[model samples]
Every structure is written in structure tokens, then in C-alpha cells.
Target: MSPMETGLIGIGALFVLMVLRTPVAFAMLITGYFGMLVLEGSRAAGAVMLTESYSTVSNYNLIVVPMFILLGNIASAAGFSRGLYDAAFAWVGRFRGGLASSSVLGCAIFSAVSGSSVATAITIGKVALPEMKRLGYQDALSTGSIAAGGTLGFLIPPSTGFVLYAILTEQSIGRLFMAGILPGLLLMAAFIGTIALIATINPEAGPRGARVPLGQKFRVLVQSAPLIGIISISIGGIYAGVFTPVEASAIGAGLVLLLAFAMRQLSWNGFCRAILETVRTSAMLYMVVIGANVLNPFLAVTHIPETLGNAMVGLGLGPYGTLAIIILAYVVLGMFLDGLSMLVVTIPIIYPVILQMGFDPIWFGVVAVIVIEMGMITPPVGLNVFVVKGVAQDVPMTTVFKGVMPFLLAMIVSLLLIIIFPQIATLLPDLMFS
Candidate 1:
């Protein structure tokens, strides 16, 4: 049998396993393992896959994963998320849709520190849900805002999804991070704008409240200065070359602990819990990465990606048409796979095709993430929406999905802007890294 036919069966088998509720990591591992045996013989496949797994897991660049996850967990334990929500609410709460707007703003900041969408959704949802409900915001708007905004973590700096994208495409991490900055900011702005528009069309959707006194607002801002400082250190330092992503994460983690102590929020038990959670999350992520390492090579050896890339480019489909198809595919696969898993599984195939189409890898990383972010908000299996709904039980799953619809449109618009003007994604990377 030809390698192509063999590869198709392997993919089919993996999909079947996934549908049957197998863990994504194990499904990929088992299918890839068996695929290799079928195509390359058992002994040869075993030696290659095992050795590759060891080297992949031990890489130094990848150490950033655990530390970044740890930083986010520590920030949560330190009560920093509340500080973010408070800061956002103080200034925005008087406006129509205040809670929903504040949730988006809070999430934008949270994204700077956390790389995972679920972490952002859970953290921000916990802080914002009750307030939104209390303020009489629509259930859909509150839940949707949190669910949609949580995706900012996927594109903002220190994003694990982007990191996985860089690793898969063999691009520079700094460039990928830099390229993502503007696109992520654009998405945030679009989301906020979308909320404002919705509120405007129906005043009841977002009734303006009495503004907080100026003095009180200033005090609230002062309280969140620590979070701002940490964000600046982590994000600003990355762009300015003041620190590598790894060092910035370490600094952020230390600052979270320090701020916790300063605010009298850090307890010994709380600290341990944060550490343990971080370890568990990090271990799970690494396992997925290790599994992908084994799985990706099997796909490569089959020449499937090479064939697909060549055929698509040869078809004379415009770049936009091809990109559209890719986006649709992500929307479907994203409902089933987590963002990191999606990156690992698809980037190996799609990213090469993207580069072959004459696009910058960094810019494509931002675009790809936005598409995956949409998936995170899409129904039936939308992870962020589920996380937010899990925390905000007052809002039904349907309402959450409805609320997120506008933001999903906003994200697509942001993606288009980035797609049309690659420099929006690439300029910062060029300025800093060049």
C-alpha cells in the first residue's frame, strides 16, 4: 500500500479515537505509534519515536511553558484578577454595558499574564460574573464577554498556543510573540467596540450607571498598579529586549508572590495550591507536546503535508480562498481539540503550507490563533464558554453562546485586518528584532 493511503487510515483512526472520547494525547500517541509500525516496520518506528520524544521533552526553550503557567497560577492566588476587574470596572462601570465591558478589559490585561484560555476564563469569570448579574447586565452579554475575552490569552504575549505555533513552524519565538501583539490589541478593541455598539442599539442592553467619584476611581487604579507594573515588565520587556520570554515569566511569578504578600492575600496553603495546580497543568501540556512530537513525524514521513501544500499551491486558488478554507477547518477541529493541541496537530501541516504561500510565519501565527480563538468560543465544545458557564451558573450555556456572537464577529474582523495588513502583525517584530 502507498504511504498516502496508509496515512489516510492513520488520520481516520485518530479521528475515530478522538470521537470515542480517548484523551487527545493518547489518541495521537497510539495512532502515530501504530501508523509508524504500518508504514516503517515496528522496530524502526519504535526507536525513532521514543528517541524523538525524549529530546522533544528536554528542550531548554520549552522550559518557559511551566514557568509561564506557574506565573498565571500565582497571579490568581495573589488576588490580582480582582484587582484587574476592579480597575476596569471603576472607570467603565458607569457606561452602558459596564460589567461586560469591564470583563473584556479585565481579560485583555489577564491575557498578558496567562497563556491558557481556560485559566483566563475561569479567573476573570469568577471575579466578573456576580458583578455583572448584580448590575442587571444580560446573562448572554456577561457570559459571552467572559468567554470571548478569555481567548485573548491565545494571541497575547506569552501565549502557549503561539509558543506551540513557533515550535511547529520553526520560527523565532520573539518574532512570533511580537507579531501577535498588535493583532491581539486589535481584537480587544474590536470586542469592546462590539459591546458598545450592542449597548447603543438597545439601551436596556447596557444602561449607564452613576459614575464613581473621581477620587474613588483614582484609588482603585492605585490598587491595580502592581498588576500594571507586572504586565509592563512581562510584555514591555519582551518587546524591548530587556528580557527573554523565560526571564520575564520568572520576574512576573516573583512579583505575583511579592504582591500577594504586600496585599496580605498570600497564605502558605494558598501558595502550595497554586504551585501544585501549576505543576499539574504544566505536566499535562508537556505530555501533549511529547505526544505531538511522536505524531508529527509520522505525518511528515507519510509526505501528506508536502503533498497537500504542493497541490493547494498548484491549484491557483487565491490566498484568501485557501485561507478561508483553513479557517473553517480550524473552527471545526477547534471544537474538539484544545488550542495547544490544535496548534501541535495542525501547524505541522498547515503552517508549512502558509509559509509556502509566501506569508510570514509570525503574521500567520497571529491569524491562526484568532481562528482557533473563535473555536474556543464556538458552541457544543467551546472550552472557554463552558469554563465561564461552569463558574457563572446564573447564565445558561445558550445565553453565553449568544452573548459571544458579537465578539466572535469582532474577532473575525480583527483577523481580517491583520490578514490584509501583515505589517500590523509584523512591524513590531521587525522594529525590535531587526
Candidate 2:
């Protein structure tokens, strides 16, 4: 059989394994390994597997993954996430739909420290949901805000999604992190606007909470000092050129650890749990990276990217048209695939096409992340929606999904704005590196 045909069949097998509930990393690994054996003999396949496994794990740049994950896990264990929510609530809770807005802001801030969308959603949901509910916020708005807000974790600085994308595409991690900042803040603003619109239309869906006194607001801000300090040190230092991405992550993790201990917020057992969680999460990411690397070689042998890129160029749809198609595919696949899986599996084939089209890699990274954010709130496999549902037991899954619809629109709008103004994603990195 032709290499292209073999590649097609291998793709099918990968999907089949996924549909059978196999983990994404294993599916990619298995498909890539055997496909290579078919295309280049067993020796090449074995060598690729062994080389990717060792190379991926041993790459020093990858240390950022575990360090960032550890920072997040430590922040969660220390209850810093709650402090973030409280501080946001103190500032915005008195306005209409303030609680919901607070949830978005809180998630955005927490996302700076915690890299996982589900973790952001779960942590903020636990803090925001009860307050919104007690203040008579509608279930839809309450659940939807947290669900949508959680997705910010994928685009904000320290995002695991961006890390994986950088690894797959060989982009600069620090630049990707910087590119994410403006887009993240823009999307956060869009979510806040959506909440305002919702509250304006149906006041009962999100009632204003009692205003926080000036003194109390200051007190809440004080409580959030540790979170602010960590974000400033890690993300701030990266932009300031005071630290590399890996160094920033290490510093962030260490500072958070020290803060947690100082505040007595984390028990010794909690610290252990945090460390274990980081290891588990890091191992999973490593496996996926290794699998993607292995799969990339087989895809190269098949010339699938070249085949597809040529076909796309032949169609004369232009770069923008081609990009629109890719984004649409992401929206559709997101309904069934986890965001990370979608990112790793497709980037190897698609990224080359994008670069060939003359798009900025950093800008596209931001755009790709926003598309993944939509998937996190889209129906069927909206991971963040389900995470919020776990926190809001009485709220149906449909309600949470429905609530996120507006924010999803907001996200699309934010994406279009970024597309029109690439600087939104590039300005920070450009300025920083300059």
C-alpha cells in the first residue's frame, strides 16, 4: 500500500483506539510505532520510539511543565485560589452580575498560577458558586460563568496548552506565554461583558450582591498578596527578562511553596498530595509529547503535511480562508476530543501548513488556544462544563452548557479581534524581546 494510504489507515486506527476509551497518549504511541514499522521497518520504528521517549523527557526546557504544574498544585493546596476569588468579589460583587464577573476575573488570575482549565474551574467554582447561589444568582449564569471562565487557563500565561503547542511546533515558550497575555485579558473582558449583558437582559439571573465596604475590600486584597506576589514574580519576571521561562516556573513553584507553609494553609500531607499531583500530571504530558514526537516522524514519512499543504495551496483559498477552515475543524473536533489531545494530534500536520502560509507562529498560537477555549465550553466534551457540574450538583449539564453559550460568542468575538489586530497577541512579546 502507498505511504499516504498507510498514513490514512493509521489515523483511523488512532481514532478507533480513542473511541474505545484508550488514553490519547497511548493511542498516538501505538499508532505511530506500528505505522513506522510498516513504512520503514521495525528497526526504525523501535529507534524512533526509544529516541522520542528519552529525548522528550530529557529535554531541559520541559522542566517548565512540572514546575508550573507544581506551582498550580501548590497554589490550590494553599487555598490561594479562594483568596483570588474573594479579592475579585470584593471589587466587583456589588455590581449587577458581579459575582459572575468575579468568577471570570478570579479564574483569569488563578490561571496565571494554575495551568489546567479543569483545576481553574473546580477551584473557582467551589468558591464562586456558593456565593452566587446564596445571593440568588440563576443556576445558568452561575454555572456558566465558572465553566467558561475556567477555559482561560488554556490561554493565559503558564498555560499547559501553550506549553504543549510550543513543544510540538518548536515555538518559543516565553514568547507564546507573552503572546497569550493580551488575548487572555481581552477574552476575560469579553466574558465580563457577556455577564453584564445577561444581567441587563434578565436581572434576576444575576442579582447584585451587597456592596463590600472599602475597608473590607482592602482586607480581601491583602489576603490575596501571596497570589499576586507569585504571579508578579513568575510571569512578571519572564516579561522583564529577569528570568527564563523555566526559571520563572521554578521561582513561582518555590515561592508558592514557601507562602503556603508560612500561611499554614497547607498541611504536610497536602504538600505531599500537591507534589504527587504534579508528578502525575507531568508524566501524562511527557507521554503525550513523546507520542506526538514519534507520530511526527511517521507523518513525515507519509508526506501528509506536504500533500495537504499542496492541496490547500492548489485550492487558492488564500491563507485566511484556509485558517478559517482549520479553526472550524477545531470547533467540531472539540466536541469529541479533549483539548490537549486535539492540539497534539493535529499540530504536527497543520503547523507546517500555517508557517508555509506566512502567518506568525506566536499569533497563531494565541488563535489556536482561543479555539481550544471554545471547545472547552462547547457541548458533548466541554471538559470545563463538566467540571463545573461536579461542583454544582443540582445544575444540569445542559444548563451549564447553555450559560457558556454567551461566553463562547464572546470568545469568538475576541478571536476575530485578535485576527484583525495580530498585535494583540504579538505586542507584548515583541516589546519584551526588543
Candidate 3:
């Protein structure tokens, strides 16, 4: 068979492997290994394929990944979740839909440390759902907000997914990290606006609580000092060039560990749990990555990207039509695939085509992330939504989904706004990273 035909079949096999519940890394690795042998024969495939496993892992920029994940786990275990909720609540919890709004703020801040969406959603849900419920918020709005807000983890700086993207695309991780800042903030703003609109339309969905006392508000703000300090040190250090990405991550992880120990939150058992989970997650991610590295080359050998780029350029459809098709593709795949995997699987194919057609990769990354954000909230396999579902089981899945409807629409509009005004995504990274 032609290498292109074989490559296409390998793609089908990978998808089947995923659906059959094989580990994604294994699926990618096993498929990638044989596919290479099929295309390039035994000796050549063995030489290059063996090297990718460690070489890909050893890149200094990639070290930031585990540090970020460990930092997130430690922060969550160390009471960062409560601190974030308290700070957000002190200011926003008295307004109509206030508790729901607080969930959004909490997720955004939580995302700064915890770049994992499911982790972010589940952690914040445990802390915020009861608070919202006790404050007379409906389960639909409360859980839905937590689920929707969790999607911010990927859009924010320090996103593990974005890190993976930067590595995959060979872009400067710092620049992509900078690009995500404004888009993340914009997404949060859109969520808040949607909450206000919902509360206004149906006040019964969310009822207000009493205003926090001035002194109490200050106290809550004070409680967040550790989080603010850690976040500032880590992100600030990276931006200022005080440390490399890996160094910033390592420093953040160490600080979180010390903070957890000081706060009496880091027990022997919790510490053990954190390390094990980190290893497991890291292994899974690395496996898929190595697979993609091999698989990517295999695809490139087919000239698929070049061929597809030419085909798209040949199409009579204008720019908007191309954009629409890409967006539509994301929405469809999102129903089943998790966001990060979807991005990694699709972007390598789509990006070259995009750049060849004059779309900015940075702008495309933001635009791509926004579409994946929809996946995080969309049903069936929405990872964030499922995390919240695991938290608030009393609420039916449909209601949680229904409650997120307006936010989903708002998220789409946010994407449109970002696309229409490219500056929204580019401004921060351009100005700061400039």
C-alpha cells in the first residue's frame, strides 16, 4: 500500500483504539511504532522511533509540565480553593447570582495554579457548590457555573494543554502563555455577563446573600495572601526572565509544598497521593505525546498537509467559509474527544494549512483554544462538566447542561469577538512579550 493509504488506516486504528478504551499514550505509541515500520522499514524506524521517547521528554521546556501539575495538586490540597472562593465571595457574593459569579472568579484564579480542568472543576466544585447551595442558589446554576468556569484552566497562562501546544507547534511557550492571558480574562468576563443576564431574567435561579462586613471582607482578602504570593512569584518570575519555565514551575511547586506543610494540609497520606497521581497523569500525557511525534511525521510523509492546504486554497469559499468549517469540525469532535487530545490530534494537521493560508498561528492557537473550551462544556464527554457532575450528583445531568446554555452561547460570542478583533487575543502577548 502507498504510505499515504497506510497512514490513513493508522489514523483509523488510533481512533478505534481510543474508543476501545486503550490508554491514549499506548494507542498512539503502538500505532505510531508499527505505522513507521510499515512506511519506513525496520532499521530506520527502530533508530528514530527509539530516540523520540526520551528526547521529547528531555526538552527543558517540557519539564515545566510536571512542575505545573504538582504545583496545582499541592495548591488544591493546601486550601487554595477556599482562599480563592472567600476572596471572590467577599466582593461578589451579595449580588443576584453572586454565588454563581463567585464560582467563575474562583475558577479563574484556581486556574492560575491548577492548569488541569477536571482538577480545577472538581476542586472548586467541592468548595463552592455547598456554599452556593447554602446561600440559596439552585443546583443547576451552581453546578453548571462550576463546570463552565473550569474550562478557563486551559485558556489561562500556565495551562498544561497550552504548554503541550507550544511544544507541539515549536512556538515559544512564553509567548503562547502570554497570548492566553487576555483570552482567559475575556472568557471569564463573558461567563460573568451570562450569569448576570440569567439572574436578571430569572431571579429565582439565584438569590442574593447578605453583604460581607467590611472587616470580614478584608479578612478574606488577607486569607488569599499565600495564593497571591505564590502566583505572583511563579508567573512574575517567568515573565521577568528571573527563571526559566521549568524553574518557575519547580519554584511554584516547592512553595506550594511548604505552604501545605505549614498549613497542616500536607499529611503523609496526602503527600503520597499527590506524587502518585502526578506520575500517573504525567506518564499518560507523555505517552500520547511520543505517539504524536511519530504520527505527525508519518502524516507529513503523506504530504497530506500540503495536499489539503492546496485543496482548501483552491476552494471558492471565502475566508469566513473556511473558518466556519474549522469551527464546525471542532464542535463535532468535541462531543466525544477531550479538549487537549482533540487539539493535539487536529492542530498539527490544521496549523500548517492555516499558516499557509495567512492565518496567524498565535491567533489560531487562541481561536483553537476557544473552540476546545466549548468541548469542555459540551455534553457526552465534556470533561469539566463531568467533573462537576461527579460533585453535584443530586442535580440531573440535563439541568446542569441546560443551565450552561447561556454561558455556552456567550462563550461562542466571545470566540467571535476574539476572531473579529484579533487584538483581543494578541494584545497582551504582543505588548508584554514584545
The digit string of per-residue lDDT tens for model 2 on 1-434 reads: 99999999999999999999999999999999999999999999999999999999999889999999999999998888888999998999899999999999999999999888988999999998998989899999999999999999999989999999999988899999999999999999999999999999999999998889999999999999867988998999999999999999999999999888988899999999999999999999999999899999999999999999999888899999999989999999999998999999999989989988999999999998899889998989899988999999999888888888888889999999999999999999999988
TM accuracy, model 1: 0.97
What tens-digit string does per-residue lDDT give for candidate 3 at 1-434?
Answer: 98778878988998998899886667777777788788888875786577877778887788888888898887876677888888998899899998899989999998989887888899889998987878778777888789889989988878887788887888877777778888899899989988888898899888987899999999999889887799889888877878767788899999989989988878888888888888887777777778778667767776777777778778956666777888999999999898867977887788887787687788888888889989988988888777888888888888888877788998988998988999987886687677
Q: Could you give candidate 1's per-residue lDDT for residues 1-434 as a string of tens digits?
A: 89899888888888888789887778888878888898889996898678868877887777778888888888888888898899898899888887788888999888888888889999999988887777677788878888998999888878998777766667777888888788888888898888889899887877675688999899999998887898888878888899887788788888877888878887889899999998898888777777787888789889999999889888888677778888889988987877776777788779768878887777778888888898898877888988988998766788888888898888877877887888999899999988
Candidate 3: 10-residue stretch with minimal lDDT: 316-325
* Runs in model 3 lying further than 4 Å from the true structure: none
Which one is best on lDDT?
2
**How well does candidate 3 score on lDDT at residue 201?**
89
Task: Find the candidate with the highest TM-score and give its number.
Answer: 2
Tell how far residue 233 is off in model 3, in angstroms.
Answer: 1.9
lDDT of 2: 0.93
**Which residue pairs show backbone clashes in model 2?**
none
- Pick by lDDT: 1 or 2, better one: 2
Q: How does candidate 2 fare on TM-score?
A: 0.99
Every model's TM-score:
0.97, 0.99, 0.97
Tell me the lDDT of model 1 at 284. 82
